[model samples]
Target chain A: MRRALILSLALIPALLSFAIAYLFQRGAIADFVWSGTYQIDAAGLFSRAGLAGSALIAFILLTFWWAEGRAEDTFQAERNMQEETRRRFFRRLDHELKNPLTIIKLGIANMRHTPEISSQQQASLDRIGQQAGRLQKLVEDMRWLSELEAPRLEQAPVSLAEILADAVALARAAYPDRAIDLAVQQAPWPLADISGDRDMLVVVFRNLLDNALKYSTPGDKVAVRAADDGQWAAVEVADTGIGIPDADQPSVFEELYRGSNVQAIAGSGLGLALAWRIIKLHKGSIRLRSRQGQGTVVTVRLKLPAPRD
Target chain B: MSKPTLLVVDDEADLLAELKPLLERSGFAVATAPDGRRALDSLQHLTPDLIILDVLMPHMDGRELLRRLRKAGNWTPVILLTQVGTPAERAMSLQEGADDYLNKPFDPIELIARIEAVLRRTRRGDAPLSSFRRLRSGQLSIDRQTRQAKLDDDAFSLTARAFAVLEHLMLNPGEIVTRQRLLDEVWGWEHAVETRAVDIRISEIRKALSAYQPGCIETIVGTGYRFIHEVVGHA
Candidate 1:
């Protein structure tokens, strides 16, 4: 529609100039015929001029069409090449790291069984194992992100409230001793379910809730609030933890980006990025609002399932 | 009885070196193969109780070997090892007749647990049934097609709610299934059911289950119910 409008707008000047030229040519031709210098018919001259104008206009349009098609072709090719490169890179990373990491982990497990190792050596071994686990998690995160770039969602009717509850349950099970006061509320009880991949939706909320719990210390307050409009559902995951700095807030949803203020916290830094990717895949919007020392609230807005869809 | 022998196939010599002693110490006679071709050659002359197949290899990959094994009527229990195991991969591995699967760089502890669970299951005069359409633990089994819970030779009729609650519990064996989770899962979230309602269905299932196996599902006081058995899944 925009292109058509632009095309019409572009023709206005051409049409005006052609009209002016045609009128001028008609006047000249009439004078020539009256003086009998050229002996040209006015109607014949007008028809010839109109044909030439049409040919010129068609040539210009053809040039524009060719240029647009070439631009799109290169753009598409570049995008596809980039995506293939990413997929190959992740595959190599996964395969290369698996066997050695396995060896390190299994070797650590075996070493601990020996009675000769001192307590200090055991601690170091444990640390090595933890770092290996973190690396494995990072690799998994990268793989999932790459997969998300393609359309891999098993879309279905999924309940946001139920998923929120499940995520809270998982978070609670994972960290039973975080000592954070947690609250969850759903406006008007149960919200209408949205169409999405159940597993992915669960992961998105689970990561959001997990991050909320992970960034907070003991006695911190974390809450989840969700509401349903007529055709959309909005949820807010808020926490009274050390909020992200203004400089880092914008990039928190980028892959592997960690806040400078969160240097002490242990994280893969892909949780929010994963959540952002998922919400975007579901045709939704996610936003983070925070102040330096106060708190952060992440709001997610998603569309409800269409009536006949 | 002699120790069970395991065939561990991978292209990484260093991993095989590290893994062999671990499995040996865990009471298995471990045999190593550098790739799928060697593993298949060994299988022609040797019968290992379990085959640990790696996903990536030089001569052939584990998935192809697995497909060939099943096509040729090799019924030995197989556990797959892979890198960055996704949900789809996990599901596919099980469907391809693998007894179990573990993501690479895993704790040796989980590996052992999976091994034992798989062994115990196959030892129970049962076929490798990770491709489960039915759920079972010992003498009690639930057929999903008929929605019937059978105990030994007797069939106990259960309400749909009870069967769903039981199915969920069986699916997540040894994990706590909270009252709220059961309600949300079984009651469809739209029904405003109390946590007390979960108790009623659990009692009905508990009475029927106790006839064959006592204390099948335990109530964890304040938290939830945990299915107290090594649940085996089958077709």
Candidate 2:
């Protein structure tokens, strides 16, 4: 509607100029056109009309430009406001879920300590505690996702090799049955260091390794390799597991998005999204390559500090 | 003999109620405080052997209370309790003088085990003479009397638990001290299935020593760390 209004207003100046020229030629300057009466110059009349028409068009164009700018400003402001509101909602939700989850966990712990409970009752309480622990993990992942969306990382000199080692050890501990290997093929004496938040980077690697281990079988091999190429330090986590489908690869980094192959698996689907956000925040990139039946490999690339001359 | 007393400070009334009875069952005279202020006030009259403090609390949190206690020259062992903590938070808490920490919704049995370990260390410290008094390896020297390490003339401070681990390693130089042995000896945790706590402290100690002397503590793959015996002189 506004576009139509602006278009009509733009045409009004040209229309008025044409109408005035027509009236001047027909009524007021009839003799001037036909017999050149009263020494009226025809070229002068056309030039004056042209100048007036240009002025009117310039005024209309300036007004339209200003209005369009205002509309864009309103749009950007609304978008930012909506984003802030969504972020706030997630923060509040995380806090609310965390407190109650803590309470439930404590309650379960208290019940388990009671010696009077039967074995059957104890088993049921164990299940409850396990489920609550899962809920707590989900809540933590959600909170971490929100934090990644708007990161406030306390960056410092962190050893990539150490972080990878810690993550690999943790994954090995968590999934003792799986065959996980860490190959630091080309790490220099102390390994290359990147300026990043150690804890956050650890979380990123842990999430990746956890996903790789979760989707794989007992005999499947998961390999993590780290190397530096002067400008960038890179780590690749590869697994012989169920790979993501071709159609689902693009949307895997989306929040809460699960693949069709992962229906039976229990997951929050926030792992890759969190990893992507964290890597981006550190001025790095993560890439994924996989075949349907083969396996998946995730490579995270981070910039290394320039070597001293 | 009187049982050792423990002060449990948490904002959760239900948790406090539940924990008090459990600790009493484990044979400790337990004192309860809802916040840091009350805990500090209780310290004036009651001298507990150890303090189990919740990190997040109303009106002065555990970290602040610990700083205050350390600032006031109270060297009572403190074990921090939290819902979930990052490595950085754990490191920060250790740096602030907490003897150890446990995650929330922890098994009661585990808490008791940690408490016993910390209490044992505190008791040992109170005794006058121990077998290992002072150790010298190269320029590095550790004095068990003052619980301090000096490299040449510069002194480097370590957390109580880290110091104990270093002392154990220094005493048995060149021996590959297994993670389990360190956990049992330094942490006093007998049935510790998770040895990651030991790994973290070892990592911290390695970081502290990396600047002055690198590779002093050698990590033996699949076993443990061996503190190299590079004795130059005894201070």
Q: Kindly list the per-residue Cα lDDT of model 1 for residues B96-190, writing each as its tens digit.
A: 98887777766687677667767776786676554678988999998866878888768898766678789878866776777755754564221
lDDT (C-alpha) at residue A48 in model 1: 62
DockQ of each: 0.30, 0.11
Candidate 2 off by > 4 Å: A1-113, A132-206, A216-230, A233-251, A254-257, A289-297, A304-309, B4-9, B31-110, B113-150, B154-235
CA lDDT of A166 in candidate 1? 71
* Best-performing candidate as measured by DockQ: 1
Q: What is the C-alpha RMSD of each candidate to the true structure, in Å?
A: 13.0, 14.7
Question: How would you class the docking of model 2?
Answer: incorrect
| Model 2, residue B196: C-alpha shift (Å) | 6.7
**Candidate 1 docking classification:** acceptable
Q: State the TM-score of candidate 2 restricted to chain B.
A: 0.58
